[model samples]
Target: MLSPNSVYTSKKLGHYIVTILTIIAGSTVVATQINLGNRYRGFTITQLISSYNIFCSIILTSQFVCSVLELWSRFRTLNGQLLESLSCVGRPGLSQLLLGWRKRGNGEDLAARLRRLQHVHLVLQRAAELLQAHVSPAVTFHLMYSVVGIIYGSYELLVVSQAQNRAESMIISPSTSYSLCWLVHHLFDLVALTVSCSILEDEEMQASVLLRRAVGIEETVPQVEAFLRQIKRGPAICFTASGLLPIDRRLLVSAVSAATTYLIVLGQFGLR
Candidate 1:
């Protein structure tokens, strides 16, 4: 059986966490904008637009994040169960040594076990593909949303820093804080999504390794060989953002580099 950690046991924990964070962050953003609205009474239209934008962004980000968390939990359970099933077959080396001494029936039993594992792996692969398809669209939109928020926030922070000497520093400070807060939230979501997917990818790689080891080098059973061939020839089961980018640590590195470059360009423009 899979361990408790393999599956997400807390059924509503993700929902609770997302809801609590959304309320806190959403409230802070709205309240900050309202305070700024009062301070700058002349910019009524600007204040309303800002509030609307922030509200919509928060709602969309929250929805996507929650969906990802839920799907991730399901994926974790499926992966864990697969690993557990593989483990039940025991080590290939040990099985080989023991089966040689036992009755011929033991060899048949080992072959049966290998076939079952192959079936289980195929089922899990199908499930992962389905989950990937379900989440790709949301992931794509969330990524675009986050990138835009990060760019805008970075630019606003730069502008606010230059406003320190202005009479409206009080107004600028709150807006900057809101932007910074929004920026951090987006970064957190991106990091969490990528990290979770990376973990799953690593686990799947290990499982594939284990499957090969269990099959061993000397065994010539056609069923087992076919299973190995399937693993080698098949595409890797992993998450991708709208089938465009794999969700992994590499994506994080690229994202950070791109965001930094954009910020630098924005900074240069602000200076000019």
Candidate 2:
């Protein structure tokens, strides 16, 4: 069983992380909105309104990212507990090599452990369901916008590096502060997404390892094998972005690499 105090503490920690990320996102977004508004002052009111709408939409997206991070943390805690519970079942489902193991009432222990494992499995399934529900609605738009934003950030960074090389220095100004804040926000977003997804993938593998060990036990417990076949029959429980792609460390690396590629293409083409 999971301790209530520990779960609450984990939740609190997640909230703190979410709060900090939100602050970073909100501040950068506000500055961006202000800057754009000034640049388009002569534009029609409808155009200005549309620009602000885009800003608000992205700010909401950052909030969703925070929520997803929290869900990932919670699932990680549940999976860890499940792994520990499986370890308690002991090896080979018996204490000794003696033939009368079942006759000595070890069956009861096996039965109880099997039940406990079932309960943990259900908890894990529910956690996945909850995460999917939250992710499904936004998954389509989320990836597209995130990729574009990160690509743009990478391009800006490249431009700044080249400018510094030519001038031997850079100056601090409002625009520079805005660029720095945007870079920080994007970098923080990347780390949060990568860590959570990687943790989720690790837990998925651990669950399979635990199930494999349970299958090897000599005990004829039907539930144990049934559970294994159910979970591993199709796929291990890992986070997916709207069933389009699985989110993991690989996704993180791929996103960054793709962004870099786009940055190079845009640079060579000279935006001329």
Clashes of each: 0, 0
RMSD of each: 5.7, 6.5
lDDT of 1 by residue, 168-265 (tens): 54334446656677677667667666765676567556545655754664465566567678778877777888878898888888888888898898
Off by over 4 Å in 2: 33-109, 160-174, 217-222
lDDT of the structure predicted as candidate 1: 0.62
> Cα lDDT of all candidates, in order?
0.62, 0.58
Best-fitting candidate, scored by TM-score: 1
Model 2 lDDT per residue over 83-110, tens place: 4444434453342232112222233455
Pairs of residues clashing in candidate 1? none
Q: How far is candidate 2 from the true structure (C-alpha RMSD, Å)?
A: 6.5
Looking at model 1, residue 135 earns an lDDT score of 60
Q: For each candidate, what TM-score against the reference?
A: 0.69, 0.68
